[model samples]
Target: MKQNAIRAALAAVFLTAPVAGMAQETDLAKRVEQLAAELEKVKAELAAQRAQAAAAPRTAAPVPSTAPAQAMTNAPVSTAWATPAAALASDTVFSGYGEVNYNRPVRNASGTQTDVRRAVIGIQHRFDDKTKVVAEFEWEHGVVSASDKGESEVEQLYVEREFNGGLRGKAGLFLMPVGLLNQTHEPTAYYGVERNFVETAIIPTTWREAGLGLSGEFGDGFAWDTGLTTGFDLSKWDPASGEGRESPPGSIHQEGQLAKSRDLSLHGALNWRGYPRLLVGGSVFTGKAGHATPGFAANDARLTLLDLHTRFTPGAWDLSALWAYGRISNTEALNATFVGNPTPVPSSFAGWYLQAAYKLWQSGDYVLSPFARFESFNTARSYAAQPAGLGVPATPYERVATIGANLMVGQGVVLKADYQKFRQDKSLDRINLGLGFAY
Candidate 1:
């Protein structure tokens, strides 16, 4: 009986110990699971915060609106008169240009060593967008001439009106709307220090008359200009010929009924600029020549001209060329007595010239242009000279070759130098240098 009681007590103790240990393990497991759930929640919250921080900068960054960009891209621009509003109110847009020249005769008549060809100042006023006035006063030889002391010659004075649709009108003294160089002859615009002989002697560059004219361009690059001007000789009074006389000794008189000796001219030009980098154009003009004397019947004169001008620029190379020809016609009898009957009555006059230019060293603002020109003309061949008298038959033929370069110093300024070989019946080779600017 005593042995049985001891075994039973031992068994009971062992069973109780196992049950208590199991309860403790169960509570510990529950605590660990709760901790794991808290840890997962914390990790998820941290991940979300990090993602929000990374995305904030992108959402807050600046972005351009559409309307302002469209306005900037569609704005209009112009180079001629600035904005229309500014041009209208401004009393005067101050602008002027000048040239200093040194010329030496290589084979001239007097072998002159020095000549100052030009020094001038110009002023312009804008009355409104459409109308403006311009005047230029010039001094030659750096001093007043003895014959006309205290008198400064007027180079140009004109009023211009611009109309809608590419049309404009001008009156007073302005350059003859004829050749390319004749209209754009700012010294910096050309390579040679001086204009070619063909232009000077035959075309007579810088030729202007008192007149009224109209000019305009069509949509497809067509342009036309015409003017009615005083006869070249009718503008002056000759004491020997009597006031308003149409004929004088050694002068060509006007033909046709007396319309008061006023001359009429018509000119037109066609251009194609479809290629943005290259431009090609041609021009023609017809007009009557001025008479020197009154009462003597003037020989009716007609002139026809043709021109080609082009500019091309690709990479570092820039090239330009110009060519022009002129023809004049008149009746034989009127040509015979004209200008002291210099030739056996020249029936016609004709002349032409070609020029080419290339740019060297075109980087940044620095540029150098080298150029050459060849020209020839016959004055009497196109006109009839009366009574073939004296003075070597007025050969009226001239050939000239010129070579030169232009150095662009800065905005509106340039240095030019050239040497010319003139092979005419009466003139010699000449060398010229000039410095000019405009603003």
Candidate 2:
């Protein structure tokens, strides 16, 4: 009985041990299968991630820190003047230009002088997508005084708007867009240390007035500008004023903001840029200058100006030419009105200039330009033969030649040296040195 019982117990033990061992083995196999499945799923996921990554578009690299800053800066830029207001910068923009000059006359034209020729500060503000305002103030000779050549003036203060179809408009005190230099007279834009004698005497650059104007491009490089402005007052004209006949036409300009508008003037300019490197233009201004002189005839005191200009650039050479003719009717009446004045207004005045420039040398950061200009003008081309031998001085005529060179140290900074020879009543020669910049 003991033996049977022991054997039965041993058998049971053996059976139970084997069953438990099998079950444990099965569990281990299941765990291994599950782990294999999980491993395969992870591998598939990784493959998919890599494929997606490869299919995606790559982004551009950030601006390189080691690249040349000037190369980036040289990129072209569009400003609010051409684009809509919405494209304008949100912050106010400040810009200006300045020039300093040293002049010495060889023939005693004037004593040698060193002075700050011009210092200008401009402020620009964009009010909306289509509206902007600009104002500029200028200081000449670096100071303002009662008994000095220094003075302060407003160059521009105007509001501009952009319309559809390449049309634009501006109002307030602004420059009259007649001549190239009238609108863009920064020193760096031209080669001379001083402005050309023709434009200065005839067109009167730095010419601005309170008026409204329109500018637009029609098509195929055709453009136009027109304006209505306050006319000059003949009452302010004096033969002995040493301005009109004795000096540049600019001297006779009544730039006074509160100027009498008894006579309004109309001016228009047309330009064509049909060729890639050439521009041709013309302008006309007509009005009664004798606003209301006590003795002058009504509208008989008219002033008319006709100007034609052209600029050409071929290779490294630039050439420009301008011819301007001006006429004043009824100068006899003006002479009769002011018989005692020494300086008498001329009935017909004319001027012209031709300029040429060549790039002598240019490097990555430096440029040298050599230029020459020829100008001729007669302020008193024709005046009423003084009534009863009132004795009006001889007409003033100027034939000038300018030779100069400009060294550009940077983008907008220039050093200029020039010599001017004059052929008129006296043969005068002058040497000028100028430093100018814009930013």
Candidate 3:
């Protein structure tokens, strides 16, 4: 029994010893795993701290870089705020331009070849957003007459007051507001060598008188212009010579013989500008020449005019057409007295023109336009002539065709070259080359 007990006890001791060793090995493995987990947590925290340090800005860094990325994203907004204020403070609202041209006539039959076609200086001042003034002084043909004895004259001096809704008023010595090419006559504004013949002989462009005018736009792209002005007379009577002439030596005057009579005139126009590429308008005017009525033979005359003007511009092509009719009527007794046996007669006139211009080169600062124009005019439809020497009768129909080019060199300056062929009934063909400008 004692031997059996000893062997059993020894087996029990071996079994307990194996169990304690396995338990110690398992506990050590568990502790090691916990320690490894703690070490991984510390490493991750250190990496995060390093990343933050790398992103932090240095004190010496540029201001732009030091700013937070969120602030930097709003830079465009801040930049835009300052632009308008600076632009408003230094706005360029006042500007001016001028030109001086020297032209030599080619084949001018009138023996009037001359230099210095036109010298003009123009100035524009914007007093505010709505009021402006434009003034131009012109020296034409080096002092008007060929003798070079007179002084240069002021061409245009006008003040423009603009209101809301395209309403405006102009006062002072401005263009007559009669035709298309009259008010705007810069070399670049018109094609061809010069203005059409109808403008020169019949209507007489650059015809301005002292006047006050109002112009405004209505609804639906319609506009109107009306004015009150001094009138003009077709004939001048010299008191010393008793001769009836076309115009006075200095200037044309409507009040003849009767200084007490004041002349009156009216002008109105309607324009449609709905089409972006086209502008069409019609104008009319009525004028009266003040004269004293002599006995049974009335002396006063009445003049009436009607005109149509159209402009079409598409791409690089430009076209214009104009027609005008005019009439002058005198009293029956006056007509009979002037021409011994005249029963009753009324004088009338008509004129028309068509022109086209094309842009040859449009790129860059310079432009070239080649153009052609056809014009015709008649001076007499009703007339009774005095004897041959007393007063010459009005000239008959005149026709003209012109070809020319305008070269624009930079802004506000231009060079014009054109040839005009004029044909009058029972007269020689005359050619004229003219250069003119506004600014």
Task: Choose the strongest candidate by lDDT.
Answer: 2
* Cα-based TM-score, every candidate: 0.64, 0.77, 0.64
Q: lDDT tens string, model 3, 349-368?
A: 67899887777875676777
Query: What C-alpha root-mean-square deviation, in Å, does candidate 3 show against the real structure?
Result: 29.2
Please give, for residues 1-439, the per-residue lDDT of candidate 2 as tens digits: 4445545655554466434577876865665566556666767876796786556533211111111111222211112122233323233667788899999898775688889999988887767556778888899998899988898998888887878876778888877766656766777767789988667777788777788888887778678889898766666665567777654356557775677778888988888776776778888887887667565543467888778888777777778888988887776756766677767777788889998888888897788889999999887777756656774665666899999998887666889999998887444688999998876
| C-alpha RMSD values across all candidates | 28.0, 20.4, 29.2
Candidate 1: worst-modelled 10 consecutive residues by lDDT: 61-70
Model 2: residue 271 alpha-carbon error in angstroms: 0.6
Which is the better candidate, 2 or 3, if ranked by lDDT? Answer: 2
lDDT (10s digit) by residue, model 1, range 1-439? 3335545644554455334577876865665566556666767876796787555432110111100111111111111122233333345655555667777776654665444555667666766556778777666665576774333567678898877776678888766555555555556555577766555544556555566877766665345666665433322223234221111211232221242444565655555544544556766666665343455444365545556666554443344555656554554544433344323333444566666666665566666777777877665554334344522243546777889887776556778888888675435677788887765
lDDT (Cα, 0-100) at 182 in candidate 2? 70
Per-residue lDDT, model 1, residue 253, is: 21
lDDT of 2: 0.71
RMSD of 2: 20.4
Off by over 4 Å in 1: 1-89, 106-112, 148-151, 234-261, 288-294, 299-331, 335-346, 362-364, 382-397, 424-427
